[model samples]
Target: MKHLTLLVPDGQSKLSSIICTYKVFLKANAFWKNIHGSDRFSIQLAGISDEVEFYDGLFSVKPHVNISKIAKTDLIIMSALNNHDYPGSISRNKPITDWIVKQYKDGAAVATMCTGAFLLASSGLLDGKSCSTHWAAEGTFREMFPKVNLQTNLLITDENGIYTNGGAFSFLNLILYLVEKYYDRETAILCAKMFQIEMDRNSQSPFIMFTGQKQHGDEMVLQAQSYIENNLQEKIVMEQLADTFAIGRRNFDRRFIKATGNTPVEYVQRVRIEAAKKAFEATRKTINEVMYDVGYSDVKAFRDVFRKITGMSPIAYRDKYNKESAVA
Candidate 1:
C-alpha cells in the first residue's frame, strides 16, 4: 500500500464544485482501506495556502498548501478547474505546472479529472500522450494544446504512467479503476455500493461491438447483444434466447439480423474472436487453449473461424501484437 497526496493551488481562494471530485476520491479511499485495512492505500489533503478563503457567494473553502514539500506518493491527482468548465481564456498557474513536471520526474503516476487536463497540457507532460477530458471541453482543449492526443469519448485513457479521465461521472470511473488495480472487483463493487453508485468493471474495454449502431436500432437486438456479452464463454442456443424475449425463434432471428447485420451465431463467433484476441494478449496459451476457454471445444473449427474473420491464424495475430508491443 502507498500514500497519495493531492496538491491544491494557494491563490485559488476556495475549492469549488470540484470538491465533488475529492468527495468521490475519499469514498473510494475508505472502501479500499476497509477491504485491505493494514498497509492499505491512503490519501492526504495538501493545500497550497495557509489562509483558507471561501469563494465569495459560494460555500467552498480555499485549499492551503504548495505542491512542493509534499510527501512521496504513488499517484497524484489534479482536480478540475472551475472556470475551465466554461469557455474562457485558460490561465494555468505556472508554479503548479512546474511542480507537476517535477513530480513526474520523481516517478509518480500523474492523472487529471475533467478540465484539469488543461493544467497538464500547460505543463507539456501530455505531449504526444493520449488523454481525455470532459466531452464539452474537447474543442478548447484541442485549440490550446494540439500536440496532446485527445480522445473525447472514452471514460479514461491509461497511457503508460499518466492517466486522465473525463470529469464529473468519470471521476467515479477513475476511482473504480484504481480500486480494480490495487484491490479486486469484489472490493470495487462494495466501494461503489457505499456511494450508491453502479460501478462498471468492464468500462475500460468495449462493451459491445455495435454499441454505437445499436443505440439507434431495435431494442430487441440491443438486448440480444447485451446477453451475448454476458454469456460469451457459455453455450448459447438461439431458441433459448428467443424464448427469454417471448418472441418466436424466426421473428427473433429476423430482428437480430436486421439490427446488427449478423446472425445470432455469427455474432457469438465474433464475440469469441474478440475474447480470443484479449486472451492472446495475456497468456501465451495455444490456439486450442484459447478456443476451449471461449466455448470452442473443436480446435479445427476454431482455427477456421479465426482465419475467416481475422484473415490470419491465431498464432499469427498473437505474434503480430506481441511483436508490435515489443517494438513499442
Candidate 2:
C-alpha cells in the first residue's frame, strides 16, 4: 500500500484542508476494497505536535502520528494555512519544513493545497519549478519566492512529483486529480460524484481579481502606477511616462520590471483589464462599450487581451459575473 502522510503544520493551519483530504482518501480506500478487496493507500495525519487548534479554539486537530516518527512516506501533503499570519506560521513550523525537504530528498512526492504552496516553497523543493497558489496572495508570493515560478493562471501544477492547486476551496479539484493519478479514472469519477466536486478544472484566471501589484517601495514606480490607474481611458505612452518621470527609457523599463514584476506596457494592460472586469461585473455595458471604456479601440485586440488575461471572452465574463444578468 502507498503510504500517504497528511501533514498538519504548526500554528493556524486550515482544518478543512486536513479533514477533507483525509476523508476523501478514506473513501477512496473503502471504494478500492469493494472492487479489489485491497487497500491502495495507508493514510495518516502526521504533525509536529499531537494536537493543534485554530479559529479561536472553535476547531482542533490531533494527528495520528508525530512527524518525527515517520522516517519514510510515499507522498507528503502540506495543508493550507492562514495567509494573514503566514510568516509567523511558517516560522513556528520550521520542523515541518525540514521534514518535508528530507522526505522529498528520499524520493517522496510532495503536494501543497492553496496557500500551502507557501510552505512547500519554503522547503526549497519548489525552486525553479512552477507552482500555483491563491490569486489574492500572488503579489506577496512573488515578492517572497522570486525563484519559484508562480503560475497564477493555472488551477493546478504537477512538476515531476510536486503538485499544487489554486486558492480557497479549489483544493477539491487537486484532490480529485490525485485520485485519478493513484487509482483509475472510474474510481476518480466515483469520488468526484461522492464529493460533488467538478473535475478537470485547469485554470484559475477567470476567478482572479487583478488588483495591481503595488507592494514595492520605489517611489517613482508607485507614481507611474498611480498615473496609469488614474488615466486608464487615455492612451498611455511609455516614452511619455519616462520623460514625465525625468528618467531614461531603458532605466524606466528596468525599474518598472524590477519593482512591479511587469513591464510598463504589461502593467498598463493589466490595469485596463482590471477596469474592464469591474465594468463587466457591475454594469450593463456591452463588450465594445467596456472595451472602449478601458481605452482599447480595436475590437479584436480588446477581445484577445481580455481572453488572454481572463481565460474567457468579454461576453462570457459578463455572462458569468454580471449582477444584472444574474438578476434577469
Candidate 3:
C-alpha cells in the first residue's frame, strides 16, 4: 500500500483542506479496494503536534501521528495556510519544513494546496521547479521565493514529484489529479463525480483578479503604473511614459520590469485586460465594446490578448462570470 501522509501544520491553517484531502484519499482507497480486492493507500494525518485548532476554537483537529515518527512516506500533502497569517503559520511550522525536506530526499512526492505552496517552497524542494499558488498571494510569493517558478496561471503543476495547485478551494482539482495519477483515469472520474468536482481544470487564469503588481517601493514605477491604469482608454506609449517620468527609456524599462515583474507594455496590457474583465463581469457590453473601452481597437488583437491572459475569450468569460448569467 502507498503511504500517504497529510502534514497538518501549526497555527491558523485551512481546516477544510485537511479534512477534504483526508476524505478524498479515503474514498480513493475504498474505490481501489472494491476494484482490486485490496486497499491502495494507508493514509494518515501527521502533524508537528498532537492537536491544532482554528477559527477561534470553533474547529480543531488531532493528528493520527506525529510527523517526526514517520520514517518514510510515498506522498506528503501540505494543506493551505490562512492567507492573513501565512508568515506566522510558516514560522510556527518550521519543523514541518525540515521533515518535509527530509521525506522528499528519501523518495516521497510532495504536494501543496493553495497557499500551502508557501510551506512547500519554504522547504527548498521547489527551487527552480514550477509551482502554483493562490493568485492573490503571487506578489508576496515571488518576493519570498525568487528561485521557484510561480505559474499562477496554471491550476496545478507537477514537477519531479512536487505538485501544487492554485487559490482557494482549487485543492479539489489537485486531489482529482492525484487520483488519476495513482489509480487510473476511471477511478479519478468516479472520485470527481462523487465530489462533484469538475475534472481537468488546468488553468486558474480565468478566475484571477489581476490587481496590478505594486508591492515594490519604486516611486517612479508606481507613478508609471498609475498613469497606465488611469489612461486605459487612451493609447499608452512606453517612450512617452518614460519621458513624462523624466527617466531614460532603457532605465525605465529595466526598473519597470524589476519592480512590477512585467515590461512596460506587458504591464499596460495586463492593466487593460483586468479592466476589461471587470467590465464583462458587471456590464452587458459587447466584446468589442469592452475591448475598445480597454483601449484595444483591433478585434483579433483584443481576443488573442484576452484569451492569452484569461485562458478564455471575452464572451466565454462573460458567460461564465457575469452576474446576470449566474442568475439565469
Alpha-carbon local distance difference test for all models: 0.68, 0.90, 0.91
How far does residue 325 in candidate 1 sit from its true spot (Å)? 46
lDDT of 1 at 104: 83
Task: Kindly list the per-residue Cα lDDT of model 2 for residues 110-149, writing each as its tens digit.
Answer: 9999999988888788899999999999888998899999
- Candidate 2 residue 282 C-alpha distance from true site, Å: 1.1
Q: lDDT for model 1, on a 0 to 1 scale?
A: 0.68
TM-score of each: 0.54, 0.97, 0.97
Q: Show model 1 residue runs off by greater than 4 Å.
A: 10-39, 51-57, 62-65, 85-92, 201-328
Q: Sort the predicted structures by lDDT, highest score first.
A: 3, 2, 1
Q: Candidate 3 lDDT, tens digit per residue, 139-236?
A: 99999899999999999999999999999999999999999998899889999999999999999999898888888999999999999999999988
Off by over 4 Å in 2: 326-328
**Model 3 / residue 101 / CA error / Å:** 0.8
Instruction: Give a tens-digit lDDT track for model 1, residues 49-161.
Output: 55434455445454434556674677777766656433231343666667778878888888777677887888899999998887656656776787999876566889878
RMSD of each: 15.7, 1.2, 1.3
- Prediction 1 TM-score vs. true: 0.54
